[model samples]
Target: MNWDDLRVFLSVGRLESLSAAARALRIDPATVGRRIARLEEETGTALFAKSPQGYALTEAGQRLMAHAAKGEAAFLAGAAEVAGQGGPGLSGQVRIGAPDGVANFLLPQVCASILDENPELELQIVALPRLFNLSRREADMVVTVSAPTAGRLLVQKISDYHLHLAATEGYLAQHPPIRALEDLGGHRMVGYIPDMIFDKELDYLEETGVSRVQLGSNSVSVQFHWVAGGAGLGILHDFSLPHHPGLRRVLPETIRLKRSFYLVRHEDDARLDRLNRLAALLSERLRAEITRQEGLS
Candidate 1:
């Protein structure tokens, strides 16, 4: 079996979808399907079960993955060792998946520094609404608010952030006062739709008997935009609040909630020289951004 085929199989197995694996590998979906088909032919057993939701690994596929993962690690380590003997002008692309908030507010400075230092390196930043699959290599690195549970992934807590309830002064003036958490019910509150991590935060408010929220778009930017436009009150990250002059924190201390941001990468990618350097640079830059924000506040 070709090592390339194995790589494709591993990606598909982790993501459970040919299309997603294809996108991660920067290849076409047809190529992903063909590689998996060839692998199955060589093994003389079905590796996956096709379903409407996505592809799932079969019993044999699961067993094959153990060996594939080991091989992949060995290959990457050897490659890195060889590459390390060369000069520092490493040339390659690093794909990063991050939340919209980070993409908009935090990553520009990081990007600038990465480009400044590694002029030969190319960086692709994919701003996603949710976490991308690092194990599948959908992203070389990920910045997320939710903690990842995948065993094959390496996660680092980059920073801690707080969220606060916010509203336009105009909106607050026209509507009832929001002195207490319960008083939030009297006003139209813009919030994330159900079944997202943001919803979990909103649910926390609901469980506290603060259930007066109107479902808004899932995008945090969208929710905050509405609040800025005087649509309604919504919870926003503390870092995001300073950018909008009209919006003010309604209950800065009492209604604050804290969450952590993580920088996650696949364990298999740890040995990639280019990836490691980029990850280090990103982590350092993000920490600096957090410190800067704290100083400004």
Candidate 2:
């Protein structure tokens, strides 16, 4: 019935869980339930069907969601227009969602700079196992290796990074020789979980004729740790490798896999000066880090 109720309804509808919606909105689950109950009562239809998995939207709920999305967009546009009267400097909190690797190894220095420049601005760094929905305002911005596919999002190619097969000197010494992809079949391989983004590493290696990789893991950091601890050969992003004495590039200059990092924000978010400034700062900082890491190898 009200904008706040519609906002809460949209959050619950998208996440399909009362608890998740509550957490995202920083409100209690009771409040979220009450708001939804009110909205449903006012509309004279069930907006959601409760299930063990989560809330399932009804047909009427689906119809309302389309209009809710447009209304939310207009509301955000109006808010940004009014905020812009204060000029271009950033204020308030900006939530940034990034994959774990980027959050851990890449964005720290950039975040520090942002804080230094705008002490009044708060930066919320959410380390997602995968990318979040920017269109739904789950995140104000995102940095990812995978390209953005959302129609209403703006994607910028920041820089390219290379992935390399790496192993500890100790492990390589004990394992069978890996002179070519064919030799990798007999050796154990540390890898990402089947459903994770880095499964491409395994697929690519298999396609290159190394069909028998011993799968081990899904976490990139864990895979790297295993490689450093002499567990097995693992494909690692070049930027993730620290100057550990035990770890070395397995094939050196012979094998390389490259992927680009993208900075993405919702197209509707373009008018928000705070979001745009944050995106620009992220792109500049990440580019420098990528260049520095590439130079190291």
Candidate 3:
């Protein structure tokens, strides 16, 4: 009946582990277990079923989750509004999950400026090579290569950026001349491992008619470095090209690849003014930064 119990329930439901919920709620595991039991007793129904893979929500719990999530969102919205009235800047945590290329080259400057302006804000960037599980709240929001097709989410096209076949100037000077796309075959290639390409958008080499990756890594940073170090030619983002002056686009007229980044967040988060403002700022700055950096490239 109390908000505190409901809060505990939501935490356990979201995290699916007593110890994990305890850590997030800053309580002990035993106390979380007791509160959950007390909540179930008050409602006269078992809300969770224990199994080998932590706690699983029961059918009753599933029914309760919808109402509980709405209540939690409402409480957060109220708290955010109240806090906003007393402050000049946003506060609390905002975690963003993004692929490594954007995380490494794009978000650093954008997030730094955001942090400078919003001194009270706590921002985190999780850079991985694969899709983030928003259902687990792995991040508050994400910058994705493609708009996700399914999920209760708000997706916005953030910006379009270009990639091109690139090689270090020194590598090009020393290796076989690349006059066209077919010329790429004579040069060693750097790219993602064929089987490890997580998204169709990331398959940049597919259209280049290149069949093999002599040096491969799932990470954009690794592949970037391999090319920057004059290891080989590979497809590289224009925004990232400015980071390495020696890296030159190869066959720009024939091998240009354009891709867009999308901003995604939980639809429920739309009610939180603080998050909405942050997301707006993120989109605006990222778009501008992409333009500025790509201009330099």
Best by TM-score: 3
Which has the better TM-score: candidate 1, or candidate 3?
3
Q: In model 1, what is the error at residue 8, expressed in angstroms?
A: 4.0
Clashing pairs in 1: none
**Which sections of candidate 1 miss by over 4 Å?**
11-35, 51-54, 80-90, 198-204
lDDT of each candidate versus the true structure: 0.79, 0.77, 0.91
lDDT of 3 by residue, 1-297 (tens): 978988889888888999999999999999999999999999999999988799888999988877887787788899888777225687898899999999999999999999999888999999999998775678999999999999789999999999999999999999889887777878999999999999999999998999999999999999999999999999999999999999998998999999999999988888988888899999999999999999999
What are the models' TM-scores? 0.83, 0.84, 0.92
Cα-lDDT of candidate 3: 0.91
Candidate 2 lDDT over residue span 216-248, tens digit each: 554556666788888888777787776465778
lDDT of 3 at 135: 57
Q: What is the lDDT of residue 281 in candidate 3?
A: 93
Between which residue pairs do clashes occur in model 2? 192-217, 192-218, 193-217, 193-218
